[model samples]
Target chain A: MGKRFTLYTTIFLLIGIGLAPVLYMFIRSLFVDGGFSLRNYETLFQSDREWRLLFNSLSLAGATTLITVLLGVPLGTLFAKTDLPLKRFFTILFVIPLLVPSYILAIAWFYCLGRSGIVAMIFNADVGILTSNLLFGFAGTLFVMVSALLPVVIILTITYLRMVNPNLEEAAMLYGPWTTVLRKITIPLITPGIALAGLIVFILTLGEFGVPSFLRFDVYPVESFTQFSAFYNFNTATAAAIPLGLITLVVLIIERFFLRKKTFIFRTMGSEKKMLVVPLGKSKPFFMVAVSILVFILVIIPLCILIHKSVSISAYTEAFIRSIGSIMRSLVYASIGATCLVVFGFFLGYILARKAIRLFYAVDSIAIFLFALPGAVIGIGLSGLWNTPGTNFIYASMCIIIFGYIAQYTALGERIMAATFSHVPHSMEEAAQNVGAGWFRRLSGILIPLAKRGMVATWFIGFIFCLRDIGITMMVYPPAHDTLPVRIFTLMANSPEDVISAMCVIMIMITLLPLGGLGLVKRYIK
Target chain B: MVAKMIVKIDNVSKSYNKHSVIKAISLDIEKGERVVILGPSGCGKTTLLRIVAGFIHPNQGKVIIDGNVVADNGKCIIEPENRQVGMVFQDLALWPHMSNYKNLEFGLKAKKIPKMETRKRIDEIFEKVQMTQFKNVYPGELSGGQQQRIALARALVMQPKILLMDEPLSSLDADLSLTLRKEILRLQEELAITLIYVTHDREEAFSLASRIVVMESGKIQKTGTVSEITAYLSGL
Candidate 1:
């Protein structure tokens, strides 16, 4: 295919499957009784309870952002730029919670802290009851959200830190101690990346649905989901989601204007020096103990609780018997969704990184904007745009969930692929073109071959995201075709705790299958 | 007459993962001398320079800087900052985030040099380097030649007893390298600083060094005056 045709087709699909539905929802939200109106929004914000919900959303987002950045920066620097031992093991351990869904973590925390929990078995019933009370509130939600999103900041920080030319830090070290050099030179350079991480966490927490809803917190996204699913009020759902959408847009706009050139660039120009690590010397053991303690408290305890809860063979047998189809569905749907996301994301990423079109920046902003919007909004928007009789094929079938995945997660693939594509020298394409190769030929023979590892990584990330995704999948799965995550949510109400915990364990294992497989493949390749 | 000894490396050696990069090589530098260590790439010239500057500790032996044992056996007894050494790295690691003025002010401020003196020193260095007009400009905005000059100025503004240059002009074109070499020679004379430079350029060494040390395979092959090294290389 020609460049222009392929690009326009990508744009059309992006709009058709993603933007158009959202635009339709916004338009429908503006009209009531066949006249243009703002009454849905007015009704949404008029009540004191709604304001309290807004407060809850803002506080949760704000607190998550603040604590994650505060904790993430030092931890990232420790892992990336210091002589802390077992760095790789610690990195993988810390990132495990991120791969699991947030609500699964909430369930794990609930099992550990609920009345009939491990504390009751080990300590006493009263302590378990008090801990249960603590776990079912804002504090619990914030803790889980922090655990889920903290990896985002650390990964970004490590990336930014690796790109910094070590000579700069070395130069600073000549005049001052490592602490001063870090404070004055290293942190200042990577602050833009830190800001970007903070922005992402804030938007994610603001739009988070699964954690708050499971914990019974009154956040705006939960209200949006409750309104649409409970009352089937599409207008009020869209109205309730508007604030998060607007907040995402506004935050994204500021991020684009300020951090676009800084945070997203794959390489720093002219500073391709290697990283230098600080020798911890006598403090090595101190820092090692500190990090191990942190990992134990944050990642190990909850996971151990889940494992302990699901120790019975009957729980696994019953869980597998009930949800075997959903597990298989999760695998199949996630695979298909991941493949589709990567292909479309490749072209969209090409536009963003290479600026193939004049409006390339706008294309990038739109994808990310959609990604950052609460997944519930995208789900409702997909349903509203497709639920009509003419579109029952999509609304009533598996296509709806896949479409929701594309609309919500194309940005993840797009962002990752854009970074991958940016590192391939554009001159290679120019040389191929000079030799009479067409755009499609150059892409297939050169770009795709060169970025094979990156594409694999992008696909893996997409699969993991789709597998653990509850926000979009829960909102839009067909009546009888629920994925494992959505099944977990639906089953949580009346099912035995052991069954839920077993399913959760199954969820984590299925997600880790690809990771472990990829690791083995990489070792085999080596 | 013998000059005062400023830097002495006593049987220093360094290795990475049991692969030796610097063997038992020893050298000494008197105050106010321009000594150039010339060698091929991967011959441990840069490693030895880093050892003397207290950035790297040799596996065996000590480094004495200005009459103090800054590094002994495998420990840096005195840190790099307290050793009063200024360096122009091979990559010219000028702070890209800061303007030239801030770059010049950084070392002085770290040493707790007073604000009035910091301003005075930066102004003096900027004037000396003919970069006064561009003091407020960042390093990225400057040309290759201009950044080289700023790197030199950043090092010199510390007013240290010793200066180390690790092929600071290798990235520039021949003409700019020659120009910066002459500038470096002039500043070394005016400041009467002990200059320890490492490079592979024979002509750069012959032109700038009062004494030359030729090294290969992590050992010193010869140490002599410029003309003697010229003869040694010619015979080789």
Candidate 2:
């Protein structure tokens, strides 16, 4: 009985803290001037411009999804199944784009191909084709967004590919060619994974704010930000965000339906069999060249452009000196947010993994829904909930930003924890129970020690996400207390090109520090 | 009448990172013979069976199935498909996404059998196994004994010249294992196919084998009839 009470209390606390802002926004949308009203929503729908913004967002997301799948599927297959040269290096190169902020990619592309870019200066001619309006609009947004999001598809596809029973392929091999076996058996088995990855990319692209805002394209998230920050109309901003949240919910429902009855536990007890590597034969060179070009476009060119533009060390030093406060604030806030997220996520993940509490699946789904929500929408919700006169402490402090990070990223930590917990046999816990160990004792002695690696990974990922976030922080950050991303976004419009480039370089360095440290630690452990 | 050889393993050896799992083993299987290779776990029984099935290449020898060389000295000279062999894995390895009927039909389709003939074979096998009622069900939906029947039916439906079983009934309870062992014996007799069964259970090996080959530490210790194996065990 005490355990049940504790479980319910934890659930309610998580929901209250994580989802209050969205709920507040929903209630606020239904009321105005202390009376029940839908006037804001009605007005939002009545505008054709709003419909255009919605169309733009959907189209961009669709284009990004298509391009991401086209690039990611073949690449994922190559990495997972073939003996590609320097495979590990290429995998890391492909994933770097995802780690770097999307807006930074947008900025890098602009520096490389904008109206007065290096290409125009090099040719001593007007490169109108390269500098056309397309570079600042849909085409540019599609390019940057696909580059930023393709890693999600590749990584998820590789994971699913690894999980496929190799014996299935060997069994098929007993009656057919490898090609026929893969086509008839392997692809069909992994189609669900590919589709899910594509859907996730689609939703992420729809919610993306930074790239579109930088590339001068008008999407709903950017419009929502404008409604709140530019027009100071909280009602319109909240109303604008509702459609996005609803669309995301519908997609989440579709995902759940598609994944129904499928066991998603990542098995850890089985013998670690190496996946069969198909020799690429003469096509190896072709793949190598193609991959090299891809790496050049995705990773090399962006960093080169940033380095070229930030040639002045004085500019870098000045920018670092000026934004040191925001930089420190970002690290501190992200660390706190990541720690809280991992702790709460461990409890929620344990509940869902063990089915410890009734209706816990609903809690899991809600967390996922919150994670998938657009950052701008989350920002609007948080402001609507906490920006009132009575909530001055939270609204005027860093807690709101940290709260936003927790709400958006706890799902990631929960998933990692759940996967880790699923691998731990229940009999071990039962054995501890038989020994008279209480819940806390079992958790600390057994579960936490076993899941320490997963917890650390969750914390690292949550930290990176919180550090890279711009849209939510932009909306909820207290006045005069900006994070690096917020500072970069605010300064982009007015700062000199060199200073901004230097700041982007600094941002990239800071991002890579933890990742590089992790790499070193892994090597030492090995 | 001359006895025809269905499988020939000549000087086969295999190693993983210099630790030999199969050391210079040789065996010959005749058509319609139930030859059970009995050994403890990690004793190379599965590896030897896999070599005959063309799933693994021998490091220093040749595997010829029905007069055609399938693998030679670490090279798969002819791939598994052309060898016309069916294997039942220890885990059953039934494709969870496929129905029992579809699973049986997959090999036939891969072999390019005609659609009508494929249906006919599948129906006949399902009827023989008394699993026709469960043909539309997935492997996950079936009972363990039912899944065992379906796995056997899937292997038999291919109509391969040779059938290999690797502890396929190890996971079931004692009663179920006994029943399935009897069913498999009955099927082997009815189909008149070559059989290479691997297991560590002494009773299972004795019950299923026309001739039993005892092995330990990657070397065959004895090869004889079931009574001979029993006598050897009694002497030990």
Candidate 3:
């Protein structure tokens, strides 16, 4: 029961647990051409192909961050704290873009902009004009990524905005007008939240594979995939992962540094829960129209196109049947993975909350390392780890995919659980035990029950990450097995826009229906 | 008549490496005694109380509950749940996720109390606390005073031989704290439970305790009747 012994044991356990895959990768990266060498890094730089791909990936991520912030802030603000007409409707509509996979959006855009496309049809007389030209390459990639990631920025911004106390705004108004208040008080308060949104989007876009890969664009993830899957060069692929991983690490470091600065105060705590709504007045109609257009372009159009494409009788039946089995496999694996994640998340969260468990900084650093590692690196590292002699359990089994899911998604679940756990006072659990509640009883009846909302949030995050995941799944999936995302990605390259559209529509429908039901239940029950 | 030594602390010295927090302190509690640990902030009162409840272990001493040594130097024998001690926190640490009923039932069920017995106990406790109407309400839905009573009922339902509290009313408003202080003393008397209360409020301690143990800077300053302690503390 010595505190030092417990602290050391915990530190070793966490380090070993987190460092296993990375250590495996490091060992593999060392072995080059029958001997250990720095050949991987040397070759990684010498090869222009991989370097270009990394460059393209970073550029696209930066572009996406820029475009996402440009659009998401105004839109998130317009929805949450405004008296604009049909605000709730627009709020739901704007978030629908998140439901549709980015690859599906690419296919939809291809349908509308192809030579015999809808845009071409509408501008038949203006065909071949520069302004009416089809978007592809960097421009098309930027457009699609912005549309894909905008919802992320919007959700984060809106949540933080909702958390800001209106009293601060009221106080600011005493000094000046609404615009000045927004510039001085509101903007400063929301900056950290906005930065968090931007950091998340940047990391996500950096690792993005579906949009860039579909558009014939070379990015780091795609390049890493090509190096391993096409050329079978594991070292080269890992080398490709390093630069992007380093970039993500830098961003994470900066985020943590600024977050620790104590520049921001959480004014929302102990304040009113009801958010203040700014009246739109004459701008209400204009804002409504603009928001409606955004939803149409982002959510509705691609969805409608996919549905139209899927209506063919034979193709629809075949794809639907294939999708059914895929859905089952994904659900089983993801559910098991989510369960494991929640268990670990809750224990660690409780330890941090109650025991004030030391080694948090080291534990957190290791857990989040994978967050910055592109899925390609995870896939490669996993394959290398489990494919070695006598350790082939993960090589062909569903376990590899599950392991990848855990590594990629545990950080998200932990973050969610940690945020909620911090709000709970440890004294409560102590009090329960003071009442003769055993550890299990305290956890089951008191701690777990008190932290249910957080647990639910953890589950939701795990579920969403599992559902939308394509990068790791693609890298590790056994041949002849296809998840929904895999099926959609394959259809992207060969099938017409309609077929891609049709599959997207079904996927979104499956994802959204349960989510909508859950939202409703949460509203009424909790 | 022989007084039952319900709990005993023998040379309980708590330290972190070289820095001793509670230095060689020994105390004993008789059955149904109301003992207040009076201390300035950062004094060793909380640490000593925590050691008795098995939340913490003393670095150089032993804690005996019901004549059994639960914690000794380099030998912590009992986990907190096995201590059969009820604790009320300074913040009235009610389980926010559970209703008053579930919170009360949790401890009993954990000890494998029969379902029927558990229900009976919960009902009786609810009646005792005058919170039967709010049994189904969560901690968030209850007023602070209501929550304070529920927390008390939760601990009492376990029929703990001793109760431990760490400034249980410190977070409440002055008016509410004053009202709850009376409720606590009344409950202690009715339940006839040994109560170890920790607080920095001299007046609150005086009103609720038969004996006050004043602490300063992680050491026991004095232990006596409320009037004796007040006179002693004022002389300092």
Candidate 2 vs candidate 3, DockQ winner:
3
| Regions of model 2 farther than 4 Å from truth | A1-6, A128-132, A262-272, B1-236
Can you write out model 3's per-residue Cα lDDT over A1-526, one digit (the tens) per residue?
Answer: 3434444554454444345765677677878878989889898889887778777887888888988998999888887777887777777777776765677788777776655666667786355233224445788878888888898999988888888888888877788976677678776788888888888889988988888887777788888888888998888777777787788789888977886453345643426657777778887888878888888887778667667667787666666765677767766766776775676567655555554565676566666777666777788777777776676655687877777777776677667777778888777777766666655666676667778888877776676667767888898887655678887786666665555566677777766766787799989997
- Between 1 and 2, whose TM-score is larger? 1
Tens-digit lDDT string for candidate 1 (A397-471): 999999988888899888888888887776445323322345676577557876777788889999998898888
In the predicted model 3, the residue pairs found to clash are A306-A501, A306-A502, A309-A498, A434-B86, A434-B87, B44-B218, B90-B167
Best by DockQ: 3
State the lDDT of candidate 1 residue by residue for B20-47, as single tens digits.
9999999999999999999999999999
Ranking the candidates on TM-score from highest down gives 3, 1, 2
Q: Score the docking of each candidate (DockQ).
A: 0.01, 0.01, 0.65
For residues B64-180, could you state the per-residue lDDT of candidate 2 as single tens digits? 889998888999887555567777777776655567887777667556689999999999999999999999998999999999898888878877798889898899999999999
Docking class of 3: medium
Question: Candidate 3 — which residues are off by over 4 angstroms?
Answer: A1-19, A124-134, A261-270, A311-315, A523-526, B1-31, B40-48, B57-67, B72-76, B96-102, B114-147, B170-183, B186-192, B233-236
Q: Pick the candidate with the highest TM-score.
A: 3
Clashes of each: 0, 0, 7
